[model samples]
Target: MKINEFIQKYRTVTKLVPGLTSSHTPHVICNDGFEMSVQAGQSLYSEPRDVADSYEEAEVGFPSAEESLLTPYAEDEENLCG
Candidate 1:
């Protein structure tokens, strides 16, 4: 599915889950019963690995150091220099 479509779907499903907080990532139960971690403001566009019986079973993975530093959301050189 497209990223925007995925984001919309995620928002819909998450509303049904209870006790989700905005301060941290939420563990979402997909329609397929596989659980995945969804960052508060981001969407999961791909199938996540490490599915289990519950959302708590889903593991959160972090990007590599290089990826973290170079992400499109990261501050650019111009912003950093200012």
Candidate 2:
């Protein structure tokens, strides 16, 4: 279906990327717990969409599952440390 039509059919759960690419060719999760991306010159979407399985599939990989960032100093990865 067309991107506009898809928007009309489903409520957006969350936008995948916050960067510039998100504005033009957005990859989004819909309220029904499925994922879809803009296609065909930002006009249409492919059919047979799938339920969002993991954040990794969407490139929304988060660092830690912990609720808080306040972790022991030793737990910090060297690359993440100054």
Best candidate, lDDT? 1
Once fitted onto the true fold, the runs of candidate 2 whose alpha carbons sit more than 4 angstroms away are 5-23, 42-82
State the lDDT of candidate 1 residue by residue for 1-82, as single tens digits: 5333443455433332454322234345455654434442313222332121123222233322233333454345334212
Across 3-23, the per-residue lDDT of candidate 2 in tens digits comes to 455444443343455521222
Clashing pairs in 2: none
Cα lDDT for residue 12, candidate 1 = 35
lDDT of 2: 0.33
Q: Considering only N, C-alpha and C atoms within 3 Å, which residue pairs clash in candidate 1? A: none
Candidate 1: lDDT over CA atoms?
Answer: 0.35
Q: What ranges in model 1 sit over 4 Å off?
A: 12-65, 68-72, 76-82
TM-score of 1: 0.23
